[model samples]
Target: MQPPDLLFLGFFAFCAGLIDSVVGGGGLIQIPALFNALPNALPATIFGTNKIAAISGTLSAAWSYVRRVKLPWALIIPAMLAAFVMSFTGAAIVSLIPKSIMQPVVFVLLIVMAIYTFHKKEFGLLHTHLVVGRREKLLGVLSGGAIGLYDGVFGPGTGSFLIFLFIRLFSFDFLHASAASKLVNVATNAAALLYFVPTGHVLWQIALIMAVCNIMGSLTGTRLALKHGAGFVRVLFLVLLIGLIGKMGWGMLR
Candidate 1:
């Protein structure tokens, strides 16, 4: 790739990281940019590169959130572990099945999520902590495993889905949901990377540059989300969900 192309991708990564750190859906930006930037690369290679870049930003955001936000470790830890394991299974499955088949399903889900979130004006506004004891842990495990699998097979809106599930199932505010989502996201990304890196699918050179840009964006986003709180994150989440819906719908149509 030329220097100009690299710059363009870096810029997109920055934007993706910023939005992803706030409420997920960064892949809605970064993945398309990667496909456009490196048309010759194999799809798996592009996906792998994306994972490497994304994981860096995710880790940074996770750390930033953990420092400031009160994470429910009992729920988060189990979820992270489940996601880590299931992500590998999802990656393995992806090697056999084409991801195109999943796009329509995901597109439909995004629409439903957007509608639900929009209609519920008070959703994700304040932390409710409805789940407690074994039920909470069970829900966390189930959500993490399912979403983590999705991330490995067809990433795109993994973060958004995670945040939404956290809010819906656990009644976490957007900020706490986002923070917990990042932890699980890091696990899923890392799990995917374990497969991709060994299979020679990642372009380390480009991924390194994108990682730096992604982290920079993550830092800025983390600060903003922390400063503004869940209300800010909720608004951004809705906007990004709209963009995700459009992107997926367009991809399916085309």
Candidate 2:
């Protein structure tokens, strides 16, 4: 095991916490830092460590959002539970595949996601509902469960995917979609960590410290999102999506 690089790791965790709090792409900051700081560490350990900090930030942001916004529990509760279950299953299969395959796929998806968000002139943040029926529930479960599986297996842009699925499928405003995104994301992260922790992969001391910082960052981020509202979040979401694409693509290429 590599000795932890406290300084770089802590700083990266703090930045990740803040970004994750805002729009849900914290791995863009944390994962690379871990790789650079502990280049010799096993991939699973690094991923497990990353989850330790990330889930902390996500849960904090989730609670903050729940307190501030009227969460649609009727829809989100089952979604979260379903997501958690699926994430565990995905984690079970993660090591069987190489990440190289996702590179081109994620890159193209990112470009399309950005363009779609841009071209749809008058879209999102309107809290409109174009979906109704069993289809809406299926969309949530299918998308949520599928993405939850993806989160545990790959984990680059799960948040953006969730937001996009909600916006396109449910026609929800960006704010509400983000709020829902947090709940499901927390579940997936937690579920993955459950498998990781028992395997003795997590760095507990660092995870605890990072968790504290993550919660603080989450508080600040949630407040900012609330103050700025949906349009601002939509923009930030796009930016994070790009970062995720770049980071994942670069990692795959190298």
Q: For candidate 2, lDDT tens digit of each residue in 1-254?
A: 33457766777788787777767788878888878887787888888888888888898888888887765565676678779988998888877756777667778898899888888855677887453556666667777788888887788778888888777877778877788898899999989889889899887876776677677777778888889998988889888877776776677668
Counted clashes in each candidate structure: 0, 0
Error of 1 at 34 (Å): 1.7
User: Candidate 1 on 1-254: residue-level lDDT in tens?
Assistant: 79999999999999989988999888778988999999899988998999899999999999999998887899999999999999999988886767767888888899999999999999999898554689999999999999988987778889999999999988899999999999999999989889889999999999999999999999999999999999999999999999988877777778
Error of 1 at 97 (Å): 4.7
RMSD of each: 1.5, 2.4
Model 1 regions more than 4 Å off: 95-101, 129-131
List of clashing residue pairs for candidate 1: none
- For candidate 1, report its TM-score: 0.95
